[model samples]
Target: MKLIGIILLFVTSMQAQNFELRVQAKTVIPGKKIYLEYITDLGKVIKIDSAVPSAQHTVNFKGQVKDQGAFYLLNFFDTPKPQKVLVILEGGEFIDIVADGVNDEDGKGNFTMKGDYPNVKYMLELMAISKEMETKVRKWNQEIQLDQKQEKRIQAEFTQAQTASTAKIKALIPQMGSHLVALWATNFLPAEKEMTSLVEIADRLGKARPAHPQVRQFVANLQRLQGVNEGALAPEINLATPEGPTLALSSLRGKYVLIDFWASWCGPCRRENPNVVKTYAAYKDKGFEIFGVSLDQNREAWLKAIESDKLVWKHVSDLQYWNSAGAQAYQVNSIPQTFLVDPAGRIIAKGLRGTALDQYLAKLFESK
Candidate 1:
């Protein structure tokens, strides 16, 4: 019995997370079919399998999942729309899905799951915590704008809030063990500020979940970050301009270029445009150039933003919104991100905004 237990633990630990969905669907019309679906990390929704419940209102979906934590959906043929549920793919255990039909209050399905439940709970908690922090940040921004006199205090409060959030997340990492949350927090760690924990988590994950895609992805992202950091050659981004001309980033070599990542719909990006305009005006003559890479899906809105902001600079995009191929090459997770490149096309600085942009350019020219 002891040897069997040891063997089982060893096998389970080595295996990637599998999924088992014991679905509930008695409320559906007779002879109706239901499909099991899962969402990819890249936001692609894929159908796993389909089944007709065996009169007991039960449908079982068993499969090998590619992700440790993923969103799955139950699509009833009889229903007008599919019902979504978050499921645990963390493997080594059963995941029982309860699709009790759509909630009348929320208009969303009351699809819940049990077994290997901690990870799912963690995901919900993480999202809620993140949302709370964002709400605070948004509130502070509004307050700061209305009362510039309180800007200093508000900024301090914001910093404190962010610090607390980081600390809370960092504290949760060790508790998460080798779960997907720990690997994901690698990206959430404050880049350089939380380097120690990032390295530790990377090493821990490398040892514990080396075969996991999230671990592999975490490692890949670190490499990309290093490649794009200051002193590294700016990655080439050659895409078509709004006009039909090929606008290559490498074409602007031998000049200071700001690889500005923004979207037309981005409020912060719109707010930061005037500062970029000011910076461009001040230093365009000094071989300073702006290469605006938009994450806009609508071409008209993108063009309108450029005209409204008077962004007299080279702009290029594939116009795929958040999934822009150009943006992906740069590993952009958020808008209003900038990569300042030197004349030789090596990245010099990053994330500069407002007068910081002007000040950096001023210093660069002054130093010579």
Candidate 2:
């Protein structure tokens, strides 16, 4: 019985030694310390190991990699354990492991590399591409700075910079297609026709790199955004209203509804409310409605602003500031955004202000 107990203890200890990581090297300098990190849905960072392992160690994580894009790993340290870690990439690959015999004595272990085993030549190519992209962007910014100093040359230089940047990005797209698609989909792509192209790129890359999680995520995000663009049926938004009930966007169908995205702190939005109020008053009896979506952190301030501005309209918010559900659904990065939906609940116009808003309403009324 004593010998059986000893055998069970040995097995338990072995089980506890397992640490699986799907690490993407952020910055690896052969024999030096490397930095790695990852991001989650809650916007939290998970840092794994920072030690310079004398030799390669086994990193086991279940995540995918895409071509020419930032790769992330879903690290699970110890099976059936809830501990999570993230490995963020800075630049380069090739981590030198310091001799730690905890896992293996040879200082070499299995890790996911850019290319198939015994050949990592593609990683060097990726590094060069990253460096080249950085250099081009930097040079373009310098020219832009010089142009900004000269008001007369500003427009020309700005245009040139934009053209050059777009060209550089386009040229590198094939090589760094995955990274470019990820960045564009996550940050750069406008809420316009550009989105369609971005989605297409993501789809293509996802097919090429079927094992990449980032590509899958990028594709998923673009699909969601594409569903919300103009001409598409407006997504249903059911949220808490001041009247102690839930208000839904779908319920406002059959009327021209202006989804006003704003915050109490937005000076431009506050200034433009008078014009909106005038338009609302004029069109209220003509089957028009205005729904106020506040991106305010403070609920009291939002309510006070609504009352003070005499914004006698349906208002709703999840009170998440920039992280608001409506903001994410509408893909709003900035405030003072407005969407004009036709009676059929399809976005007809966006970002209309002052004269533009008035002109659109006039056209809508005249057409009726």
Candidate 3:
């Protein structure tokens, strides 16, 4: 009896952190392999394992999950374009996927996922909604780009679609409760506009999956967001200027500052420079300043862009490219990103461009 008890305990421990994923393909071609892949925090996709379907047209993958909230991609690599499905696998899950061998005329996938785990079901559903939204937006943008009126109409349509998609995703969050799907749903919304909801979901997910790597990462991102959000103190940045002297953002205190993150290779940044120049010309004497931070690897190109744009501003860079110290300090993932700081050095707004920047500055300097 004692030995039998020990054996049962061992069996239970063996299966505790493991998951089994089985796929049934309707039309399995010879020599084609299926891959199980996961993306890293840095957005690099790593292929973990691959398997060939058996004579019965089924393939199985089994592994122990390191952590929950990690999204995995199942890819059928033999197709003209690989057919892929996104799935979430917590430990101790048995997930089955049915794949239709042929994609539709529009290349839409005909697949269904079944799992006893409620989170898996919810995550898959959320992924479906996200994919649908992306498809709709892409199709709308791919139309004609002839006239300004037509462009305005297309943008309005895009805005309507985005509003409806956000509403749909938000409506599903309450039903998800403390599940990670609720946290994932918040990602579909703008992070700056929905920080309160994001923080709440992060709190709930922290209680449920405290040890998960993804949860930890999400919490860290929320902390960073808090530091950069409106009314929050802007993170400090100190980098070398074009003339070889170090300048600190704190030194520019008592003035309204625009922290512009750009690079010479960025086409949009070059195009937007004229508008920025215009805004600067209007406000430079009104206690307004521009602190340009370049994420350029080449020093020559950076200097040439600054000169060519007629940008008479305090420009600084570590010239580390995307790994620029200042860019990372402010969580800048794209070029031509700007943060507006008031005289008190608090972040007033972010990502302002063109007419938006002009309108904001106009209202701000109306009194002076």
Candidate 4:
């Protein structure tokens, strides 16, 4: 019935609502043309409208939109240095833009959008914070590579910044509610740590804007998160161990087990081995166990890393790199992903690392 309604709406073109875009930019030369464009799923840009600025350096564009909003690029196409500002065009909106025409250093946007444009406002805010965090991470990474003497200090600072940024991003995502802008913010969250939140947002947006193309795409993309969301049953992972015998994640169901997805070649994973080893040693006798799933293709490298890192826990791998069945089942696109499962085989937490992992384990086992 929903599909039929959407088809009928498309056929009748009755869902379309009028919109007006008013721009005030000192940089837009009078008599120059600016374009409003949207990118297709295949990434091809399609120009939908154009406006010529009057002698007052202002341009006005009128259009119609469907209930499902579109993300558009407002480009100064005829300028010497063409630049674009992204706008979310929801139906029935009268959007106003104010700009000096100077390009944003971060390449996000220099223009400030006004009027009832919550999605646009939130999307731009998220982009700004994301860019700021990325710049800090890049600087820290460069310093770590250049100066060996301060690696620990740099790493601590990096971790602190990452944790803070992740917290801030998470706090902001809920404010977006079911807006498509929430989809943009979800990219900043670590899937393992925030799977529950991601799934909730997906469910909400899926219902709120089921017919929206981007919303449908985002909800579909997060299907993996839904499977392993907190309290969901941990997916079974049966693979060959390092010594060649088959083992299953279910075998450790009588205790707290962490499904550790890592690769021998992963630098961050290798560096994090010591913390895992420490955590394992501290809680192994208290019914805590780890099931390490290696995404390494090289047999010798995998064995060497396990031995060198003193990882004495049960470890398995198909030696198929990222194509390992375990990785595919858990949707582990990035290395060092983990799932903490209870004795009942339900996932409790994920992406725990460093001191956070230790603190959590202490809370769980120390009292017992």
Top-TM-score structure, candidate number: 1
TM-score of each: 0.68, 0.48, 0.63, 0.53
Error at 204, model 2, angstroms: 6.6
Which of the two candidates, 2 or 4, achieves a greater TM-score against the reference? 4
lDDT at 154, model 1:
71
| Per-residue C-alpha lDDT of model 3 across residues 86-184, encoded as one tens digit per residue | 776667889999887556665656788888786776777777787777677556545633444565566567668767877777777777886655655
Clashes of each: 2, 18, 0, 0
Task: Report each candidate's C-alpha RMSD, comma-separated, in the order given.
Answer: 6.2, 13.2, 7.1, 10.7
Best candidate according to lDDT: 3
lDDT of 3 at 187: 54
Ranking by lDDT: 3, 4, 1, 2
Mind giving the per-residue lDDT tens digits that candidate 1 earns over 139-185?
A: 87788679878866875787788788888788888887877666555
Candidate 3 Cα misplacement greater than 4 A, ranges: 1-10, 24-33, 39-46, 52-58, 75-84, 98-112, 139-147, 150-157, 231-233, 236-328, 331-338, 341-346, 351-368
| Cα lDDT tens digits for candidate 4, 209-274 | 888887776676578656767899998999999888999999888899999999887766887787
Evaluate residue 160 in candidate 2 and report its C-alpha lDDT on the 0 to 100 scale.
61
Displacement of the residue 240 alpha carbon in candidate 2, Å: 1.0
Off by over 4 Å in 4: 1-16, 29-32, 41-44, 78-82, 100-109, 138-146, 224-368
